[model samples]
Target: MSSVWHARCAGLMITSLALFAGTAWSATISHAAAPAAAHSAPAAAAAQPAAPTYQHTASYQAAEAKYNQIRALQVQAFDASECIRKKDCPSDESDMLRPLEQALVLKRALETAASAGDRDAAYFRAKVAAEESARFNEEADIYTGFQDPAYKRSAGLAYERAVRERDFAKNMLVAGAIDLHPWSCMLYADLNMAAQPGVNNRDAAFNAYYCAASGFADRGLKDLALKAYAGMLKTGHPQHPYVLDMHSRLLNVRPDNPWRKIEPSGLVRQPATTSKTSHH
Candidate 1:
């Protein structure tokens, strides 16, 4: 499909996902670690040549197709979210329903590709898992984790999925973060803040956000730096004593920043209003 189609699809996906507030999707990546060496490494190395790169495999092609689809779905989802923000969304339920249904189809395709050991598919799966993990965590908060049995069970499932997916997605993100990849740093921050079991580390979250913000600033991407700062604040880590010092640097960042002019409608919290009554 063309780039325009991809964008439209992504917008649709974003719109559908946004229906579940506090679960917005974001871009992310991961890096896998090197396997340990075998005992007879020298002999094995002499007997075998390196394997071919993925570009030469059919799995690569399949992954590329799924990747494009995922990107398109993400774009469409975002666009749908934008429509809702502008209050221009279609009132008809199907307008929203169809794209969501399409997302399921794409997800199945992604799974198929991943089962084939496609790298891109694995990455996409991890991204999807990360989003789900964050969503479940937010939902889990309402029931306070161990409070309600039914809610706990449901949330537990989500938590499990998120953890598995994050693990699947971590390698790439770690690699990218190390290289100071802005998106990677920000994504790593997001994954950390999901508050999933064994994944909740305020210090690490603080560092990832700080890395992203400082890196952006160094590259003169003031707008991105501001966004990163906002992420840091939103991640519930603002009170971390170690991160306290950076607050001053980003104190000026506001919910109305121009960098996110196209942000989703609910991205910023609106102030409460009071109704006044008059008696004659």
Candidate 2:
């Protein structure tokens, strides 16, 4: 009887231990599985990025199309203006008024784009305004140069009107320059020069070109800055000490400038180096 009781007690203890072990194992498995599920959830979410909606895509595509259309028109107007300027196509000047009319249209479009927050369009519009002003000024001169009294009288009035419009172009040029448009700054500098007859303001022209050169240099456009610097030299002011110093400084900064290198006269000379022989 005693042996049978001891055997029964041992069996009961073994069964209890097995039950406890099974419970502990199930808890461990549940805890590990929970962490894995939590980690996988964040990982899965992180793998995906937000995508553009249909409306965004449509709006972007529309803007791109409009921008491209305006660019094409601007290009066409630019080419036509070039042709008119060169007198390569007199017919264009007779009817379509290649530069002024087409440029005016482009100007308006560019203005609209600028108003809509397009900076490049504003710069382009400023350039067109400058071109229009120049063309008008030229036309005014041609008309005033007419030998006939009747033509001269009418053309003189036109010339005065053009001069007034040219003032507006100067304002546009200033606007573009303030916006840091390099080409506009150049045109502005040129317009302010005393090179044209009856317009003598050497001081103003020199200052404008100097400012442009400094701005371009600050923007890492050393080449363009060099051009503006050269323009200062072109102003009978080449002998000025300041001009000479600036030119020398720029040459030192850019020894291998492509534009300057292309000019055979501006080539820099290399100094000969002599080596000493050592006798042992």
Candidate 3:
């Protein structure tokens, strides 16, 4: 579809995903050690001959038609989400469901009506994944390899594209008035599936702990936030800045903090509530 559609769809996608509160979608691409010998296959292929690039201009009309429909659905989904956010009650008539639920259900219908399993149908999903990945430096290089710096760059680009695409699709679904509540969950599902299983579980666990702490802090759920910080300390992350920053947020009111109660059990007591954290 048009650029306007692309932008609108993307806006909706981001709105839907952000609903998950403190949750995010992420993608990663890794560069591995190269083989001792250079990759000869690509070199040989390059030397053998050159092939013409297919523009697919001949298929533009069909692509545009599909793009336009997806675009419209995205708009619909966005509107539905607004209703859900404002606490409009669902009356249970055909017209009243959370936008997230509607978004997913609607998208499924679109997917069915369109060419089944068509690569085009996934265009927006791919874009969202790509964007989210780029934020953390992962990109996709579909035709490239981990061996080339260009491959890494391409991979990052692809991931960024995927993130953007996914966001847009979900947003569109939400706007269209589908089960909007689950849109974030759905986006997360896509994101987690695309994430690296993680070579560093220790880091991941601590990171999650701190992340939860941050959310609780924002929501004034200080007790829960402190407990989260304590949970991370239990994991013994060596108090890196990432970990310490989280603790610092608790120093004030810490004695009053729930975690400090464990001091009798030998947990390091957090300082008094009147105290403040300093960089020193």
TM-score for each model: 0.39, 0.48, 0.22
Against the hidden true structure, what lDDT does model 3 obtain? 0.50
Task: Indicate the residue-level lDDT of 77 in model 3.
Answer: 59
Off by over 4 Å in 3: 1-199, 234-238, 251-280
Residue-pair clashes per candidate, as listed? 26, 0, 59
Residues 132-243 of candidate 3: C-alpha lDDT, one tens digit per residue = 4544443354534568787777776666665565555544433212222222223333343354545334444455555556655665667867776776675546557866
Q: For each candidate, C-alpha RMSD in Å?
A: 33.5, 17.1, 35.9
CA shift at 261, candidate 1, in angstroms?
A: 34
| Alpha-carbon local distance difference test for all models | 0.65, 0.65, 0.50
lDDT of 1 by residue, 1-280 (tens): 6999999999999988786553332221111112224435656868897754323346546656665676577667656766766656674445555676777787778766655545455545556657656665566565555676887787667666656767656654675577676656777787777655565577677778888887766666668888888777776455765246456555545556633565577778999999999999
RMSD of 3: 35.9
The number of the candidate with the highest TM-score is 2
What's model 1's overall lDDT?
0.65
Model 2 lDDT, full chain set: 0.65
- For TM-score, candidate 1 versus 3, the one ahead is 1
